[model samples]
Target: MPVIEIENLRKTYSMDGGLSVEALCGVSLCFESGEFAAIMGASGSGKSTLLNILGCLDPPTAGRYLLNDDNVAALEGERLAALRNENIGFVFQSFNLLSRTSALENTELPLMYNHSGLGMTEIRRRALAALDRVGLAERADHHPNQLSGGQQQRVALARALVNEPSVLLADEPTGNLDSRTTLDIMALLQQLNDQGMLIVMVTHEQEIGAYTRRILEMRDGLIIRDSPVENRRHARAEASGESTTRLNATES
Candidate 1:
């Protein structure tokens, strides 16, 4: 079964004078396990709105969304929050780490909301493992202020991973990093996806989107093009100064 399934998803916003704006217009998509996909569009194209709905941050005005076959489109309050915490992990552009919290502590915060009954030792162990996966284990004791942008983002990624969520949702995760650091983060994300983590990312940068396996181009609240990347860029190879070649979509 697909990790995520949405059918005719719609989201509208109320404006002044009893007017409304349709942010999403019957958008439907599915993402399977281990798939790494990117959503790209210009400003006001509804990519952010779509991501918000997917992340469980907002409910769709209409339609169905199934995460691992559970209907979550209309879930609200504690139920929605619980479902989000249990099944989805989020990484944002701002690296939303607590200012004074240590990396390990920040990574452990998600577990506080978990009802799994895991003890502190197990929680710390999982957090450390997640940090190690992101190559930040050595920095676990450091605060966000003491780390570089890339390092802080890794901590954010580790925090997102600590819950072992079924789907990883990233919104402009590389937006604040330099090109080189962005490549590093993409490489890490690719590795995780290779290990069977479903990753959905929103990016406006074509260069960044090239790192993913599939691209969905959005326009005016609809996906205009959905195609597999013919010439998927390998960040490890790119970081080593290799010349990359592009292929036609049919070649994929």
Candidate 2:
């Protein structure tokens, strides 16, 4: 079954003078387990809106949205929050780590809220494991300010993954990083996806989108193109100074 399924999804915001702005217009898509997909668009193209809905941060104005076969569009309040915490992991452009907190503590925040049944020892164990997954186990005691941009982002990713969520939602996760750091982050994301994690990322840069298996191009609140990437760039290969070119140059 698909990890995510949406049909004719729509979202609108009320404006002045009794007007409304359509942020999403009849959007529909499905994402399977272990698939890596990118959503790309210019500002006002509805990509952010789509990501917000996908992350369960907002409800759709109309339509069906299913996460792991559960109808999220019909849920509200704590039920929705529980579903989000249980099934989804989020990474934002900003690392969103607490300045004064240690990386391990920051990564433990999610569990504190939703997994209260877990003891402190288990929480610490899981958080440490998560940091290890992101290649930051040794830095677990360091604060966000002590880490580089890429390392901070890795901490954020570790926090997102600590719960072992079924799907990962990244909203411009590499937007604040330099080119080399961006490639490092992409390589990490790709590695996670290869391990059966479903990833859906929002990015405006075509170069960043090239690393994903599929790209969904949005324009004016609609998907203009939903196509497979012919020669998906491998970040590890790129990092090793290998040529990263499309198998079919015309695929884009």
Candidate 3:
């Protein structure tokens, strides 16, 4: 099933004068359930604009956006906020964790805003479980400063997963990590994707993009290329210095 669908989506930003910048230009796309895909482009290519609209952080100036079969453009105010909180999860390049809070507490931040009637006990339990999924349960009490960059990103990922969202959106998720740590993070992501979590990531690096099952390259506010990986990178295999199969890319 298609969890996300956008048709002729457009976004524009107005300037002081009678002028505007079109960030997204009549872009149409669909993401099915359990799909692992990446959006790639240089600066000003509208990849971020499209991601914002999909995550419900911004509304399109024109066109339809459907999330889990609901028309997202039709929602406003609290309704939109609720939809975003309930179904979409986000991870950023910065790791975005609070400096003062413990890893568990950082993961609990999303649930705090949800108002789902979950008690503190239940919330903590869920948060801990999320941390455990990312292999950081033992360090739950550690502050951001105490954790390494990769561990911090794991906390961020756990926070995103705590809500049981329909899809996970990551923007340059490993941009701050070293190469070895990048592989570790990507391995965790691959494990999650294997277990049927839908993931869409935005990255400028082709090597990082190679880990995903599909790649969508955007340019000038349009998707110039949409191709499936004939041979997707297996994070664990590469991490162990084992050979990974690669097939020729065929257009989709």
Candidate 3 wrongly placed segments (more than 4 Å):
242-252
- lDDT of each model, Cα atoms only? 0.92, 0.93, 0.92
TM-score of 2: 0.94
Per-residue alpha-carbon lDDT of model 2 for 122-146, expressed as tens digits?
A: 9999999999999999999999999
TM, every model: 0.94, 0.94, 0.94
lDDT of prediction 2: 0.93
Candidate 1 to truth, TM: 0.94
Model 3 steric clash pairs: none
User: In model 2, what lDDT does residue 112 have?
Assistant: 78
lDDT of 1 by residue, 1-252 (tens): 899999999999999999999999999999999999999999899999999999889999999999888899656678888877888899999999999999999999898888888899999999999999999999999999999999999999998988889999999999999988998899899999999999999999999989999999999999999999888999877765632333333355
